[model samples]
Target: MQVLAAGGDLAQLTASGLFHGASYGALGAGFALILGVTTRFHFAYSLTYTFTAYAAYSLTAEAGLPFWPAALLGVLAGTVLGVLLELLVYRRVAARSGGDGMMPVFVASLGVGVAGIALLQLVWGSQSQPYYGPSIEPLRAFGASFVNLDVYQAATSVVLVLGLAAALRYTGLGRAVRATRGNPGLAAAQGIDVRTVYLVCFAAGSFIAGVCALWYGLQYTVDPAMGTRPGIYAIVVAFLAGTSASPLRVLLVGLGVGLAEAWSGLWLSLQWTQTTVFVLLVGYLVIRAAGPLLPRRLVGKGA
Candidate 1:
């Protein structure tokens, strides 16, 4: 509380907070969509979705394009890669291994992740490229300087969360997705084309992840292995959110985690910041997994 009150450096804190929040928000959304819509190959889809966006940003920013254009290109490339992977790889693997069993799919996803990272390193030359396109104008609010990029990132994240929530809550496509998630076999029997739904879900998830990558790249330099940490953190956030399929909840959780991390970094050492988040996630997951064993009234009673 004292440290926060002192607010060692408001400008740096705000900038870091916004980027971290935005990055985690994108991750949470991507993982939630994958888990909600297509449970069989969520990890594989996530890996591709994240890495493609990272790659796109690296390629475009290195080429000296504007940030928006670079971000757009990243999103497009991620969408394409996601669709291709779904059609060419996951679809075939799922078919041969029997869709009911997820082990083969999980293993395949791990393989894909390994291959993807290797390929990324090969093409991107394993070097960190500085991301420079446009400088964000600074503004003063309440006697503290704030970077425009922070506001932009925060706004974009909020907008995406709202838009996604609206689409899922009030759209026919959303209904189809829910139906598929509830019972893919039943949805297929009803002529809903479960495969197509999976494809679409993967595409959407990838697109969101691409946006995350673009924003992340814009703030920090691009590196071949950049997606690993954020991807892992996203999966953790999704798990902690209790598989609720609520983007708002996920966004809030991400932001909370971000703020907590920022505060920790301010008061503690940088090395301990990530450690604190990991501990929090572990504790949350333990409590969550134990919920089913507790009495109904005790579970989530106050939360």
Candidate 2:
């Protein structure tokens, strides 16, 4: 409270909160596409998708390109890398398992993560590179100040989340995904191409994650290990939301967590700030894990 009241660090804290929300939203979207519903090669694709975005950002920054062009190239390269990973590595592993068990997929994702990090290190030389671009002009409105870039990034995340939710709810593609996730065999019986749906979902998730990578690069320095932290946080957020289908819920959770994290860091130390997220994750997990263990009559007899 004293630190926040001091006011000197408020702006930086606000900016960090916005960026953290965006990162969490992006990561949540990526993992949700796999664990929450899609639950297959989608996870593997996300691994590749995140890795490709990191690699592209590193390449562009190292090459001295402008931000917009670099972002464009990064997204394009990410899409291509996503496609290749899906078709080559994921397809082969899925074929071997005949899409029956999850262990093979999990192992394959680990392999992909290792390979992706190694490739990034080889190309980017394992050093953090400065991400240079136009400084965000801050504006004050209604007694609240915000960095323009943070506002823009948060707005972009909201738009993407809404667009994605709408597409999944109203579009034919969305129906196919729901069907596949609900029951692949039944979806196939109804003439839906399950494999195609899986591929498209993976691609879409990766694309969103690529956009997130660009925003992150704009806010922070690009590094080979950048995705690891965000990726873990995203997983926690997704689970905390209880596999929520609402993108709004996901966005809100991200933003709320971001605010909490920022507030904690301001009041405490930076190290405790990181620990707070894990603490929240563990607390949520315990509550969830205990839900089924409680007596049913005591759990919800009146409700």
Candidate 3:
């Protein structure tokens, strides 16, 4: 109430929320791809992409490379790392364990995440550094201020997400991936190379993660731990959207979460932001869980 009365600028908040929501949606969609197909919880994905952004920013800022080339380098680095991990580590584990090697893969992913963070600390000394791009100046319009870069990022995210979703729905690669996800053995028996699908999925997810990292880097400083919280939130968003949910739903859920997070900051202390988000998540889960039971209970009572 106090913030609103003091000219809180709802429009600005809305724009920020949309931008953040798009970011989260991108993260969620990527993670969903990896999770849905691989069935391996990739904890390292967050840090991996963050490292890519940091490395790319450093290349551009310190190495004197142009932004596009630097960004491409960052994305390629992340994608290669993801594909290598899948091919060298997870694939070997799966081969040894007969494709149910989720435990080894999961543990290895955690170890890799820790190693990535430590390596980043050693190289960057845990400092937060800004990207080399021009400072984002807000464009004021309709009695609201908005950052043009942020809006551009949001648009890019949405388009990429929609495009990926469409590809998954209509393309042959998408069918192969879906087939592999449904049953690797059957897919393999049907002449679809499961390994190839896995490689594609991992690479695609990693590329999306890299894009997300770059966009986030544009908004804030690049730090070793920058992706941690958002990564966790992305997992939650993925679950909320469900594996079979459409891309638009996932995007909408992400946007809702972003809006909630941004709006809460106006009334609550910054420290309480995560707490509020989790509380809302829990409340939503409880409602969703109980919603189905209510109909059953009512039928029983009527009977």
> By summed lDDT, which 10 consecutive residues of candidate 3 come out lowest?
1-10
Score each candidate by Cα lDDT. 0.72, 0.69, 0.80
Full-model lDDT, candidate 1: 0.72
lDDT of 3 by residue, 1-303 (tens): 244432545666676777888988887888888888888778788876887898798889889998989998998998888888888877776678775777888888888889888898898878899886656777876556777788778888898789888988899999898888888889999999888898898898888888888878887889999879878877888777765556677788888888888777677766775676688668767766677577765434322
Error of 2 at 69 (Å): 4.0
- Tell me the spans in candidate 3 whose CA falls farther than 4 Å from its real position: 1-8, 96-99, 284-303
What is the alpha-carbon lDDT for the whole of candidate 2? 0.69
Q: Report the poorest 10 consecutive residues by lDDT, candidate 2.
A: 41-50
Which structure among the candidates has the greatest TM-score? 3
- Residue-level lDDT of model 2, residues 154-229, one tens digit each, is 7777788888888889999887877777787899999998778867766776777777766666677667777777
Candidate 1 wrong stretches, greater than 4 Å: 1-5, 8-15, 44-67, 140-146, 292-298, 301-303
Best by lDDT: 3
lDDT of 1 by residue, 105-144 (tens): 6777778877887887787668877665458687766545
Q: TM-score ranking from best to worst?
A: 3, 1, 2
* TM-score of each model, in listed order: 0.86, 0.84, 0.88
> Which residue pairs show backbone clashes in model 2?
none
